[model samples]
Target: MVLNVDNYHLKSLDNLDVKCDITKVRTEVIFRQSNEKIGHGIIIQSKHFDRVAVFAPFSGIIINRIYSVYVERIPRDQQWNEQESGTYWFVPSNQIPELVPISKYSANDRELIGPLVGVVVSKAIRFAFVWSPSLGEGICENHENLVIGGWIKFMAE
Candidate 1:
């Protein structure tokens, strides 16, 4: 998905209302064309599965990688109160155990790593999917650009 500049609304990383360690965050690179680096982004995961937030470093058109596919477009207003309303885009055919390199996983992340489905960018937010070989499936959202810090803690309602 591509978000035009005119319709885009920028969310500030410093102004994030969620409580998280600004220093402990991780950065992911957002590419413009193939191999062309565009910007950076931050991924904010909620302790709860209800909601996730992505922050972009700058204002620009957001594009999803080919590995990721568009499942649906949800309007901010139509969001449901329950976690089930959130979209979890996953493709069974794309499932591959240990798709992410083992070196990238920490001791605590051993059970959390799996094959990546792809990335979807909408409104400056990137929604990523990775299927767990043992578990089931999980999704993460980060800034359209590369994320540069550690996980920020947010109180999930």
Candidate 2:
């Protein structure tokens, strides 16, 4: 499956009925172009096993994006740090053949987007894409319940 970020608009969560699981929350500090401190990138996971969704604690435009793939099949002793290895091979979104407009994705390619990359939304939300041989690729924001609602709302627009 492939996901095309260009197809969606970044909507504000003020009106959304979603509730983030604060207990599982993780955060990363963000900085502006001027090197000023901005809000943290808040990551909230769902309690339900089947759902995934991520929220932007603050708003900003996507400044950069990189596709990450893991080479973990290699022996553990031979494996390099997952972060360095995965990101080292990251191709820019523009360079990726799969990161196209949503309408351009075939049925099989639709879900491929989740595991391909991390998006840096300037001073906003940043997502880290991780891959596992057993689990395949999925967006970090895997909220089954909220995903359906969000997708429905996103599609309606």
Candidate 3:
């Protein structure tokens, strides 16, 4: 339950801003981490009550690996309206709020730190998406399919 991504980069709000430099995304929860590049494992589920979510990658569309992610709903309490605490507010994936994958974790039980999707945008907001599962439907550009920059975890109450 540790996904502390906040290297604070910017630019994302409506023109589907495509800048780039999401701190060089390379997951494994940020390559076994040492200092920054936060992210430990992933988990998601709400009504059934399993929570631990984090996937804060954003850069418009990192080459179809579907970059723009900002799904956050952790041990936070409240903050969701003009939210800008540590900053990271890209938005457009249809205002992202619909994901579901229940379980899957690994640190070395067999080299598996992928699959961990999520959703539960209510009990204080919860949204998720952990990638690098070989980028199957990771993401691509958008027009009608909707993937066009996203960010939506706000907590501070």
Candidate 4:
């Protein structure tokens, strides 16, 4: 199955309000395409997933992610009321750009044109740092240990 992530949206009764821009818009998943000046955005592997999940890089202490996929460094950990809606983070299969590996959480990111970011979806095996709901409705995934203004990486499983 293909992970079409643009159709996703995230909205909360609290302070979380995000929208998925990869499932439909055919986004351009980019990383450090150029401008080596900015670090912590070295995004690579765009063609690996059809849809990408993007969450708010909100400020906090408990940075959560889906394992090797995304990383964030927060300052504190507070119990959120739970997001009402979840958004998508992805690029078009033709817009999937290149990602340069420069450290990890310090690189440049931008938009480019390429193929749709494709991710393999399987109902057989599960992956580490990744989870899919039994109903495939809500997301029950997050990365632990992170700081503020940090970077996150979510790979295709």
lDDT of 1 by residue, 1-157 (tens): 2112222232345422222311111122222333222123222212111122222232342432111111112233643431342332211222221123335544342232322212122222454332212222334444444233212221111
The C-alpha lDDT values of all candidates are 0.26, 0.23, 0.25, 0.24
Residues 12-112 of candidate 3: C-alpha lDDT, one tens digit per residue: 45412333413221122221122222233223222211222334332332221212223322323334321222222122223333222223433232323
What's the distance in Å from true for residue 62, model 2?
Answer: 4.8
Q: Candidate 3, after superposition: displacement of residue 81 in Å?
A: 39
Clashing pairs in 3: 78-155, 78-156, 78-157, 79-156
Error of 1 at 24 (Å): 28
Give candidate 2's root-mean-square deviation (CA, Å): 18.5
Question: Which candidate has the top score in lDDT?
Answer: 1
Per-candidate Cα RMSD to the true structure, in Å, reads 17.1, 18.5, 17.4, 16.6
Ranking by TM-score: 1, 4, 3, 2
Per-model TM-score, in order, reads 0.20, 0.16, 0.17, 0.18
CA-RMSD of model 3: 17.4
TM-score of model number 1: 0.20
Clashes of 2: 17
Candidate 4 segments exceeding 4 Å error = 1-53, 58-111, 124-157
Q: Report the lDDT tens digits of candidate 2 across residue range 1-157.
A: 3222333232234312322411111111111233212122221111111112122222332222111211112123534443432311111122212122435444342233232122211111333232222232334333222221122111110
Which run of 10 residues does model 4 get worst, by summed lDDT?
A: 66-75
